[model samples]
Target: MTAIPAVTLNNGVTIPQLGLGVFQIPDAETRAAVTTALEAGYRSIDTAAVYGNETGVGRALAASGLPRDELFVTTKLWITDLGRRAARDALRASLDRLGLDRVDLYLIHWPAPATDAYLDAWQGLEDLYAEGLARAIGVSNFLPEHLDRVVALGGTVPAVNQIELHPALQNRETAAAAAARGIATEAWSPLAQGAVLTEAPIVAAARAHGVTPAQVVLRWHLQQGRIVIPKSVTPARIAANLDVFGFDLTAAELTAIDALDRAGRTGPHPATFQG
Candidate 1:
């Protein structure tokens, strides 16, 4: 098994650079998918309250018999649960479903800026961190302005900022903002949800490296110093995604992929997304 490198967060906690993401996996099927990843050497699992699959994740964790300290579990607070009190309760509920006392990481699922409640949510996360309910806290889909406000609160800075990033949508602005704040950038929808798998640049790189296009793209992300959680239910892909450490993309190859960005965003823009 290839040893996946860990990215040390600003707070000194370590997170696996490559992990399994259960974004759309239904509750009934998430356990098997997670189990497959764990068997293939994945220790990090990203889930959210909106996904409604934490119980399934709990089942897989229980069956794996992996020590609690060895696994990195992450869950999020939804927009409806953005206030300080609501955020705490939501995580408690998530922990109940996950069958764990503390999550490795917890995040505010979305900024929902219109509601202007994320600051309260961040405060809640700060309290949770102090209470030892979450080892680390972060925000997802937050733009630069949103990050600034969180930082201005003078509380715990976010350990990670997860955003929709891929060859088609680099999201460099937000990524840069996160970098400036000493926050690790985690790329979700890293393959553009398969939209970039067949691009000429990726295909050429795949052929040159004798790897799949998906592998080539994942390598593109890893080489750029970003955390990626590519989701796949196929057993072979689950194993192959972790095999990216065996290859490296050349500078020119990386640049070619970088040029493929077209501002193609599959999800709602964080600035105006109410939820």
Candidate 2:
């Protein structure tokens, strides 16, 4: 098994650069998928309260018999669960469902700037971190402006900012903003939902390296220093996503992939997504 490199967050907690994402995966299949990834040497698993699969993920963790400290589990607070008290209760509920004492990272799933409650939600996360209920806390799908508000408030700096990122939607501005603040940028759709696999540059790079386009894209992300969570229920692909450690993309190859960025995002824009 390839050793997945770990990215150290702003809070000094380390997370596996590559992990399994349980987005859009049905509850019935989540456990099996998580089990397969664990058996393939994956130590990180990213899910969210809205995914409706935390119970399944918890079951797999229990069955794997892997020591608690060996896994990096992350989940997010939904938009509806904003505000200080609601956020705290939401995390407790999430913890109960995951059957874990603490999550490796907890995040405000979305800023929901329209509601103007993310800042309060952030405070709740700080309390969780301070209490050790969460090893680290951060936000997801947050734009630069949203992050600016949290930073100015001067609590805990977000350890990570996960967003809809892929080769086609590189999101350089958001990534750079997070990097400037020492927040690690995590790519949620690192493969562009299978849209980038057949791109001419990706295919050529894969052919040159004797690997699949998926691996090529994942390698591109790793080479760029971005943490990527590529979701897959297929056992082979789950294992293959973790196999990106062996290859390195050349500078030109990396640039070619970067050129594929159309500024096209597959998910909702954080600035306007109130839900």
**Best candidate per lDDT, number?**
1
lDDT of 2 by residue, 34-59 (tens): 99999999999999999999999999
Once superposed on the true structure, which residue ranges of model 1 sit more than 4 Å away at CA?
none
Clashing pairs in 2: none
Model 1, poorest ten-residue lDDT window?
1-10
Each model's lDDT: 0.95, 0.93
Mark the 10 consecutive residues where model 2 has the least summed lDDT.
Answer: 1-10
CA shift at 31, candidate 1, in angstroms? 0.6
| RMSD, every candidate, angstroms | 0.6, 0.7
Q: On residues 1-275, what C-alpha lDDT tens digit does candidate 1 reach at each position?
A: 67999999999999999999999999999999999999999999999999999999999999999999989999999999999999989999999999999999999999999877999999999999999999999999999999999999987999999999999999999999999999999999999999999999999999999999999999999999999999999999999999998889999999999999999999999988886
